[model samples]
Target chain A: TQLLEQSPQFLSIQEGENLTVYCNSSSVFSSLQWYRQEPGEGPVLLVTVVTGGEVKKLKRLTFQFGDARKDSSLHITAAQTGDTGLYLCAGGRGKIIFGKGTRLHILP
Target chain B: GAGVSQSPSNKVTEKGKDVELRCDPISGHTALYWYRQSLGQGLEFLIYFQGNSAPDKSGLPSDRFSAERTGGSVSTLTIQRTQQEDSAVYLCASSPRGGGLTITEAFFGQGTRLTVV
Candidate 1:
């Protein structure tokens, strides 16, 4: 079975602090997607990384794809209270395999 | 709909009862997917429909779970004899095209929360 394992199941940091979440897999993926979900709502796509060793930035959030396409990471710089949410990583090909996710809380 | 839409935002059913969840994909989307998210867990893919044809149903947990799409627009998922373990958020998503040779982003709908008691 294809599985994406995420680290640091839960994180709580003060405002202005930085954090990083990781998604790792044994199988290679064609693409990797990052999503953030608020309570009672579905996940909102944050970014997609298709190329190996690629890095993309959106505001304070940065996403990196591993050179082998078997892992990815999300780094949040100077997190704010609004950044508190469930963050998920999905590896996609014909179907998507999701990681358990990182539940982050940015205390202000 | 401008985005994928799911019906009955929340449902509470007794064990052994059956329930149906619906999904309306965005217009022009050809690939639809069903997923389940348990508390504090990741999304689990359940099924995939490509323009009214299901090319992959391997993620379905059991025979009691079945889904179908009609006219390449809306899809329905039926869960027979609901169990307490089945309680979760059922999510639906749609993509522009099937991920056969290339990958595409999927737009998701606010999921339906099912509670079996």
Candidate 2:
């Protein structure tokens, strides 16, 4: 079974703080995606990285795909309270496998 | 629908009872997926359907867990003799096309929260 392991299961920081979440796996994936889920709602896709060593940015958030395609990371700069949520990484091959996720809380 | 849809947003059932969860994929989407999310855990893939045909059912936890999609639109997941371990949020997702060499991001429904007593 392919599994994605995420680090820093929970995070709490004041507004303007920066943080990073990591997702790692031994198996290679064709693509990786980042998602943010709020309480009582399904996950919302943040970005999809298809190439090895690729990086994508959305506003204050930046996502990176490892050179081996077996790891990924999400970085937030000057985070705000609105950025609080559960962050999940999904790797896709024949199917998609999701990481356990990091629950983030940014206090104002 | 604008996005994937799931019914019975929440369900509470007694142990040993049976429950069925439903999913309606977005219009024109050919790929649908079923997943289970325990509290604070990642989404566990249960099944994947590509236009009414299931190419991957590897993630179904046990024989008691089965799902089917018909007409390439709606899908149903049936759990027999429900147990406490089955309590979780059952999520449904769909994409415009199947994932393989071509990876497509999926859109998810709000999910059905199943609680077994």
Candidate 3:
């Protein structure tokens, strides 16, 4: 069985602070995706990274896929209150597998 | 539908009863997936279906849980003899295609919140 392990399961930081969460796995994936989920709603896709050592940016967010395709990271710069939510990383081989997620709380 | 659609946004069921959850994938999408999520947790994959091939049921928790996708468009998840532990938000997602060397973006539904009392 393949499992994705996420770090800093819970994080709370003041507004304007920078934070980074990580997702790691022993199994290599063909693609990795990041998602943000607010309360009472399903996760919304943030970005998908398919190449090793690839980086994708969406506004204040930066997502990186490791060269080995076994790990990924999500870094938020100057996080705002709107960034508070659950950040999830999903790795796909023949099937998609999700990390437990990091719950971020950005204080206003 | 413009996006993945799930029925009965909320369900409160008694223990030992059965429940059926429905999902309507986006038109022309050949990949459908079902997942269960507990409070503030990551999605627990339940099942996956791609095109006309057999579904990947490896993720189903037990025999009590079963799902079927009809005509490669809509899917249904049935849980028999429901237990309290089964309470969670059941999420459905769809993609243009999946299950090979490539994967596409998945569109998700709002999910159906199940409460077993």
Candidate 4:
């Protein structure tokens, strides 16, 4: 079984604080995807990185795929309260094996 | 466009009872998947369907868990003799096309949360 491990299971930061979440796996994946899920809702896809060492940005959020395609990261700059939620990195076949997840809490 | 949809957003059932979950994929989508997410855990893949038949059912946790798709659109996941361990949010997703283990942009439904007593 392929497993993805995410660090900092829970994070609480003040508005304007910056943070980064990590997702690592021992298996290679065809692509990696980032998703943000709010309470009581299904996960919403944020971005997908297919090429190794690729990086994509969405407004204040930046996502990067590892050179080996076995790890990924999400960086948020000057986070806002609205950014609070669970951040998950899915890898492997891109069919998606999710990590334990990082639940972000941005305080105003 | 209409997103994927599921019925019985929340279900509370007794142990040893049976429950069926429904999923309606996006129009024209040829691939559908089923997943389970226990509270505070990541999604656990349950099954994969391409068109009307399941090409991958290895993810099913046990023989009690089975799924089928008909007319290549609507799919049903049936759990027999439900147990407390079966309690979780059941998520359904569909990609525009079958990626065959490759990841594609999959649209997800609201998911059905099942609670076993």
Q: What's the DockQ for every one of the candidates?
A: 0.67, 0.74, 0.72, 0.55
lDDT of 4 by residue, B7-79 (tens): 8899999999999999999999998989898988888888888898787787899999999999999999999
True-contact fraction per candidate equals 0.64, 0.71, 0.63, 0.49
TM-score of chain A of each: 0.97, 0.96, 0.97, 0.96
Sequence-dependent TM-score of model 1: 0.97
- lDDT to native, each model: 0.91, 0.92, 0.90, 0.89
**Tens digits of per-residue lDDT for model 2 on B20-114?**
99999899999998999999888999999999898899999999999999999999999999999999999999988985674688899999999
> Residue A98 CA error for candidate 4 (Å)?
1.7
Which residue segments of model 2 deviate by more than 4 Å? none
lDDT of 4 by residue, A1-108 (tens): 788899889999999999999999898888888889898888899998989999999999999999998999999999999999989888655255678799999999
Those runs of model 3 whose alpha carbons end farther than 4 Å from true positions after fitting are none
* DockQ-sorted candidate list, best first: 2, 3, 1, 4
Q: What is the C-alpha lDDT profile of model 3 across B1-117, one tens digit per residue? A: 698899989999999999999999999988888999998788999888887454578989999999888887988999999999999999999888887665677889999999999
lDDT of 1 by residue, B1-117 (tens): 688999989999999999999999999999999999998788999998889999889999999999999999999999999999999999999999986644677889999999999
**Candidate 3 at B62: error in angstroms?**
1.0
In order of listing, the candidates' clash counts read: 0, 0, 0, 1
Off by more than 4 A, model 4: B100-102
Clash list (residue pairs), candidate 1: none
Over all chains combined, what TM-score does candidate 3 have? Answer: 0.97
